[model samples]
Target: MRGITLALDAMGGDFGPDVIVPAALQALRYYPQLELLLVGKPAAITNYLVKYNSISNDRISIVPTKYIINSEAKPSQAILSSQGTSMRVALELIKVGRAHACVSAGNTGALMGLAKLVLTPIAGIHRPALMVILPHQNNGKTVVLDIGANIKCNAMMLVQFAIIGEVIAKQIIGVVNVPRVALLNIGAENTKGFGNIHQAAKILSNISSINYIGYLEANELLTGKTDIIVCEGFVGNVTLKTMEGVIRFFLSLIKSSDDSVQHNFSMNTNIVCNFSYMNPDKYNGAYLVGLCGTVIKSHGAANQQAFTTAITQAVKAVERQISKKIASRLAECWITTE
Candidate 1:
């Protein structure tokens, strides 16, 4: 595969270009086959680049943009009025085929809205959904989707999500054989969730290609029982946040327990290392799946390390030809979207 070029919205996150530039430098140093286009005020990004002592002039360049989409900006405002924002500019680079992928630690709604408008969806896809990788049992991982893309979805949309999720697991997650797929529901029975999930399940079961494994409850999400979990944005977002909160709570509680100083220190360190798998920073980038081009949305509050991981995710997705693969799969399935 050819080298991957990624565009970044340098001023999108809470820390702005100061944090983004360093991360870009780190990614460049790590992946010799990667190049970056930093979209923000040229002077600001240059200052950070020099401060970080990153003089890899050949691998990194800057694209200046005057406006920035603030965290509080609405999706409609971003889509209709914020043409000059760094986030929009980064995406435009991909829309015009100047970059292989774009990564931004920006407002999710604004990112999603602008991405659909600028990059558009895959031919038969109605809307793109945000998907994140989660640590599964036995040091494995799983892909969960619609973490906050479309709050309301019909049965067909859910089925479409399954297809996108399956493609991701196969290509990006490196699932060797068929990935076991399941729909997230209140219970493991066929009669749980709403009618839409039931309908989606029926559709999945009839499809001979995927290893459809029926319903999965929230508790079994990280148990590695299934490789992909599908749900509407509202439920998936709740499930994701709840898991993050719970993991942090347990880690904190484990550290505070009364014990000998040496033992406590050792145990705390081990727990922190082991539970690092649950850290959202490790999986900071969530892809807006089913788009015509690659677009990754990092958490708005992502730190430098987290944002760098997001950039890495974008590079890997581009290398895997995720967008092209998803389009080919969808065309083969021939699911009509109007």
Candidate 2:
């Protein structure tokens, strides 16, 4: 297999270079064919590389930048002032074909805005969706999309999300059979959601190519009944955060339990191991799909391991030629968001 290069926004996350440098080093060790373009202040990146004794590594290179986007900057504001920032520079690397993919732990809105501007969307895609894979009850994985990309979506956009989700389930998640896709709704009944959602559902049901299951309520998200869940960004974002909060709460309860109870919990290796699956770190990378190139959004507060996971996710997407696969799948559909 030919080696691939990834552009890293080393100054974008909460801990910036302090966290990113180590993650880059770790990923290099894990993948012998991997190369990194660390985009940030040279001094800052060098300090950490020296600390890790990887400053002189042949595979690592630093691309210096003069500015960093503010974590709280709005998308519009960030776009206007984006030049010279590490995040924008890293993305530009992909635009110029210097890197195969880009990964950043930065302000979500800015990253989304910069990426759309620099990398451009796929030919037929109106908007790119933020996608993540979540663990399901049956020990399988579920692909959820539009997590935080577009806060408001119309019937056509929701339908488009289903199409994108379906392709993702098959190509990325490796779903063998026809992937069952569903709309996230307030109720499982046909008439229980907003007009656009109902319209989207009706449209999905008519498509012969999609395995469109009717509706899925929020409570049944982990039931493993569906392969892909599609929703507007506002609802999907809230749902993801709520699930994360609940997982953290459940883990805390186990930690604060009585000694005997904790001892019993620990002894049940299966239960303990299952609970560990809920760790948010393992699911840190959110793929920004529907774009022409691969861009992964790492959690802003992610630790070293989580950031490394994000880098690996980018590698896999590039290796799989995910964007091309999505484009090919979309061409087969008759639906249009225009």
Candidate 3:
């Protein structure tokens, strides 16, 4: 909460400067010590800052960068072929010590790709995986790892996800000791799954990396007992989408409810009713774990609130020293080159 200056991609996101400018102003109120170096068009950014008479111009500096990285743009082309995009510039800020963290509501694939290429990974990391928190049916929330980083993984990779998931749970979710973990599968029993999952269970069991609670069906994600769920991106993406669709279905029901039904039904009826109303992009931001610096990805179509939360998420990541914790956990397993 001291003096943490964040580098934000002003032209990123669907709404462009319209969403980014206002959200930056909103974050200032919550984080008084927050300093922003807007990375995008100068004329537009200056005009937006001029609207706020209470804030000084120097605090809202603009770092010029041309071109916006579209959601449709290939991740490789944006990261490798072009260097003028705001997303790449933000990461460069972290690399050169100009900023502490980078937050972008840009292309998820480009963000993930650039994070690995620019920020690089810790000494012992092979690749970075994406993780996010979802509300559980029992109460609190559950951590889902490998949202869509890698579609295919080996037994060792899945086991790594379990250990990585456990570390994230301890840091962000505040689950101390060993958190109960489950592998996403067709059934609960160990005999139900195949490929990396079956092999993963054995690897996880022997490594003693986390509190393995065995396999969990998609329905069990928010069931409360499990603290973390690990699986490949193909399965994880499907599960996430299904949960999103379910949330949308209930939201429509709530909106269309008649006065008679409204009188009979309380607003607090469903457990995750409020959370369920959230947009997929709003609750869909993921952190690329195993990186040297804090790298977070929000949906390209994200709204203002989600963009602000991504900044808050970045703050927590840096303050908690998540990179250090992950490094420690990785070193315990893999041999360090540095």
Instruction: Give per-model TM-scores.
Output: 0.95, 0.95, 0.90
Which runs of model 3 end up more than 4 angstroms from their true locations?
52-59, 258-284, 334-338
lDDT string for model 3 (181-209, tens) is 88889997767877779998876676555
Model 1: runs farther than 4 Å from truth? 254-263, 335-338
State, as a TM-score between 0 and 1, how close model 2 is to the true structure: 0.95
Candidate number with greatest lDDT: 2
Tens-digit per-residue lDDT, 220-305, candidate 2: 88999999999999989999999999898877766666344656664555655787786788878999998999999999999999
Q: Decide which is better by TM-score, 1 or 3.
A: 1
lDDT (C-alpha, whole model) for all candidates: 0.87, 0.90, 0.77
lDDT for model 1 comes to 0.87
Deviation from native of the Cα of residue 8 in model 1, angstroms: 0.4
Ranking by lDDT: 2, 1, 3
| Per-residue accuracy of model 1 over 117-218 as CA lDDT, tens digit each | 898998889889999988886777899998999998888899889989889999988899898899999988777779999999988888878689999888
